[model samples]
Target: MNALFKALSHPVRRSIIDMLRKGPMASGDIAAAFDMSWPTITGHLNALKEAGLVSPERDGASIRYRLEISAVEEALAFLLQMTGAGRKDPGDEP
Candidate 1:
């Protein structure tokens, strides 16, 4: 989980995740969205991949990244548990 948070710590990485929300995208297209050098964007993608927030599949000559919804759901579930947002009502207990 620490890795997930660490990967999300960077704005660039968050943006990349947001981009993937629409659908899988080529690595080159992702890099085109940012002004930084290719290596920098690649590093961010690697971090996201390490965190299990994204998956990369070879698409012919390029790689396409897809968002891993399960990882995001896990993070959201953790936050919900911490905040008691979805807890069952004690008064309703049998």
Candidate 2:
């Protein structure tokens, strides 16, 4: 999907998703892993959320982010389709 590709276009966002894949993480914790400002990290997270690649929740004073693996799978499926993996069976050919 366009959104998934857009979200993954940045290396930072990919790394952020990798971090979250282990489990949900607080916004601060995710930001701390990088040498960037909190607001900058927040923006990246927002992009990921917009792409449906991640989900966020408010916990106390921090927002926790989690990876949406299904979105990643959808992207992968799109890629596979491009490679002809999604074609119908030979018996079903027109």
Candidate 3:
């Protein structure tokens, strides 16, 4: 969970996930959206991967990344906890 929060803490990473919500994208396409170099974007992708926030599948020579929505849900669950709702789980909403 710590890894997930850390991965999402960055604006670029959040933006990447937001863009991916539209659909899966090639790493190059995602990298192109930022002014940073490809390697920097890749580092963000790696962090997201470590948190299970994103998963990449190989298609021929290109790698397409898909967002794991459940990770976002987990983050929301954490927020709910921080809000002092006293709910142990996100699904326990009254």
Candidate 4:
């Protein structure tokens, strides 16, 4: 999941993911939310797509990006496993 982590390393990509959490959004709409140029926003979207965090759907002439929750879950599962979550410890006081 190096690609997933790498894509998430950027603040812009994180913001894009956050925006997509609401629902699928057009590329133009996503780009409008950022101060950077369209090309820069596109690069971030490409990273997210490469990481499987987002999927692009063709909506007529525009492309809408939707979040892939399963991929996100995969990442969360990894983090939870590394953190030892949901594991009962018998060495604790009752």
Candidate 5:
């Protein structure tokens, strides 16, 4: 999807997704891993959320973000299709 690609276009956002792969983490914890300000990291998180790549849930006073694996799978499948990978050619023999 357009939104997914747009969100993934930024290195910061990509890194955020990588971090989330481990497990859900508090926003503060995620911000601490980077050198940028908390507000800046928040912007990247917002993009990921808008693209459906991440979901934020309230955890008491803090919010934890979790990766949406289905969205990642959707992107992977699209890439595979575009590259003719994991897809059979119609002319191939059975």
Candidate 6:
């Protein structure tokens, strides 16, 4: 989707997604991993959330962000289609 591509256009947002790949993490923890201010990191997180790439859930007192793998898979499939990487040849046998 357009939103997903836009969100992934930023390196900071991409890093955030990579971090989330291991598992859900608190916003504070994610922010700490970056050199930028908390507010700046929050902006990236917001972009990712808007794109449906990440989801936030209240974990006790803090909010934890979890990666939505389906979004990433959708993007991967799109790219593969563009490159004809996974498509079967018309003449190929089953």
Off by over 4 Å in 6: none
lDDT, candidate 4, 20-41, per-residue tens: 9999999999999989999999
Estimate, for each residue in 36-70, the C-alpha lDDT of model 5 and write its tens digit. Answer: 98889999999999999999999999999999999
Residue lDDT tens for model 3, 1-94: 9899889899999999999999999998999899998889999999999999999999789999999999888888889889966556667656
Between candidates 1 and 5, the TM-score winner: 1
Best by TM-score: 6
The predictions' CA RMSDs to the true structure, in order, are: 1.2, 2.6, 3.9, 2.3, 1.2, 0.7
TM-score of each: 0.96, 0.88, 0.86, 0.92, 0.94, 0.96
lDDT (10s digit) by residue, model 6, range 1-94:
9999999999999999999999999999999999998889889999999999999999999999999999999999999999999899999899
| Residue pairs in collision within model 5 | none
Model 6 per-residue lDDT at 91:
97
Would you list the rank order by TM-score, best first?
6, 1, 5, 4, 2, 3
lDDT of 2 by residue, 22-84 (tens): 999999899889999878998999999999999999999878998999999999999898999
Tell me which residue pairs clash in candidate 3: none
By the TM-score metric, which is better: model 3 or model 5? 5
Query: What's the lDDT for residue 30 in model 2?
Result: 92
Judge candidate 6 at residue 40 and give its lDDT: 94
Better candidate by lDDT, 3 or 4 = 4
At residue 7, candidate 6 shows an lDDT of: 100
Which of the numbered candidates is closest to the native, going by highest lDDT?
Answer: 1
Per-residue C-alpha lDDT of model 1 across residues 13-56, encoded as one tens digit per residue:
99999999999999999999999999999999999999999999
Q: Report the Cα lDDT for residue 84, model 4.
A: 97
Candidate closer to the true structure by lDDT (higher is better), 2 or 3: 2
TM-score of 6: 0.96
Which 10-residue window in model 2 sums to the lowest lDDT? 85-94
